[model samples]
Target: MLNMFNTALTALNANSTAIDVTGHNLANLNTSGYKAGTVSFEELVTQDLSVDSSDINGNGIGAPVLSRQFTNGTVQVTGGLLDAAISGNGFFTVQGSDGNTYYTRAGNFKLDDSGNLVTATGENVQGWMATNGVASPGGVPTNISIPPGSANAPVPSTFFGMNMNLNALGTVDGTNGTFTAPVEVVDSLGTKHTLTATFTKTDTNAWKYDISIDGGDVDGGTAGTPSSLATGTLTFDTNGKLTAPAADAGSVEISLPAFANGAGEQTVNWQLYDSAGASQVTQYGEASAVNSNSGDGSTAAQLTQVVMGDGGKVMAKYSNGTQKLVAVVALASIQNPDSLVAVGNNNYSTTPASGPVSYGEAGTGTRGGITANALESSNVDMARELTNIIIYQRSYQANARVITAGDEISQEILSLKR
Candidate 1:
């Protein structure tokens, strides 16, 4: 009778644990990246009723073992620029404050005050940061930083080009043939200056050009006066194509002295022809007008936004209409993900049974690709959990009834003896 009571008690404990596991699954049904756990019951030791007989007595059920389902959950598009999700098999590697490494599938990430990409609980996301818009992910990873309010360094003007037609029927050696085009350029200090190109029809099929800047822009220069920086002659053939300056030497060099604002002297290249040997400056009977002009220079710009890009790239946009790669998120793959122990916060730590972790960029090797602007929903199945709950409840009741029946039989035997 005592042995029967022990067996029923053990079964009751096992069923109770199974019920707890089901409840846990139901509780985290909405948790991001939460893997549902299933309860597995193992049979306890059985006793042989008789050495030569085939009859056997079942002892009871042992403790229930909870195993997590490592299958991927459905991806939910959150449309958040910083959010990310894994489409296949992989985990986002992160470093907790305790200086220990962990992995997670929750990618509802945000930038901390220090500009480090971090999880909701403030763990630093590990990856390779970019330098000068290039990301070079190596064997080791570091905290990915995309600093807010950052400034892109200004680039000084190196070259300028224009395509236009200089009137062929204009008066020679006078203002009537002169056409002035103003082009803006940036100095080393990011200061804007207008470089004026003046062309004069000095003779048939020939023209004189002068490229100048405001006198006040250079040291010891008089204010409001044009300081000539370059002078050259252009000769065109009968077909209206430039024939004097060789195609290889179609660019004039403009040398600027030290600026009043303490900017160093720099040389600018003025291109009259493109790389394909096509003349940018043409002598035609039409009115002289600059059709287009371009300069390779820009002022410092502020950071506009940081967003998740394809292939797990972190992209930063600037106010100057430029985008740069900030970093690439790292993904880790384990041979047996089920061997990983859940450390809470939707993170997992590796154990010996999990084998070694292989870290790499997403979509490489056994790693999975990343889905930007999304998050992974919990993998719990509500209907399945509810069904398990009902089954466990029934099992618990049945075990309790066995204990009650054993109590009644003991009372009956004692009463008969009395």
Candidate 2:
């Protein structure tokens, strides 16, 4: 009778614990990146009942053990630049304030005042910083920083291209027709200079062109006056296609003299051909007009915004209309994620049962791909939890009834003795 009472008590305790675990899951139904908690019950030691001691029956229910479900959560698009979600398996690695490494699935990150990316609890997000616009995934992970007022150095003009139409019906005499096209180029010191090209009809199928710069010196010429840089003749075939100065040899090399403002001399290659090795200048029977002009140079630019991209690449956009990779978010995968020790704040710490963490770049190996401007909703299913609540409630009541029945049987035996 006493053994029966003890068994019922143990069962009641286990059922109560199970109910509490279900309540916990219900509480975090809307929590971000929250994995549902499940309670598992195991049988306790059984006692031999027969005289031979070979046959045995269960003694009582054992304590319930709580573990995470580790199931994937629904991804919600939040449209926040730093918001991120894992589409498969992996956790975002962060360095906690306790100086211990922690992993989390919640990616609601923001830039701290010091420009380091951190979670709501202020843990530093780890990643690799890009150098020279290139990132190495195998590099060591460090705190990702996007300093305010960050600026990109100026890129001197190395190549310039223009598409234009040169009038084929212009008079052959140089005095009768001249066309001028101006292009903007940036020097090493980010100083803008206007390069003017003048074309004069010199023959029936040829035109002489002169490249010069204003308020500057060209090829070490005197400043404050137009200085000629290069002079060449462009010969077109009868079909109006450029035939002379073959595509490979159709580049103009010019040098700019040092400016008074301390800008260094800039050497630029003026490309006459486009990417397809075709002449940009056409000798068509139309009015002379510059259709488009482009150069590979820009003034110094300040950081405009930092955007998180798919595959965990953090890109910084500059005011000069350029984007560069700044960092790569790191991800960690464990053999048994459910065994990870939850240290609160939606973070998990490694345990012996969880196995070793496999660190890698997002979207690589068993890691999941990152989704920017989004977040993962909790995996908790409210309807399921509610049903579990009722089941556990019934279980608790049944165990309590068992204890009541055992007590009544003991009382009946006592009454007979009285």
Q: Largest lDDT belongs to which candidate?
A: 1
TM-score of 1: 0.81
Error of 1 at 343 (Å): 0.9
Candidate 2, residue 102: lDDT: 92
Show the lowest summed lDDT stretch of 10 residues, model 2. Answer: 214-223
RMSD of 1: 4.0
lDDT agreement with native, every candidate: 0.88, 0.86
What is the C-alpha local distance difference test score of candidate 2? 0.86
Candidate 1's C-alpha runs over 4 A off are 1-3, 47-50, 53-56, 146-150, 160-181, 197-210, 230-256, 269-295, 301-305, 316-323
lDDT by residue for model 2 (6-36), tens? 8888888998898888888888888889988
Please provide TM-scores, in order, for all candidate models, with all chains considered together.
Answer: 0.81, 0.90
Error of 1 at 337 (Å): 1.3
Question: How many residue pairs clash in each candidate at the backbone level?
Answer: 0, 0
> lDDT score, residue 259, model 1?
89
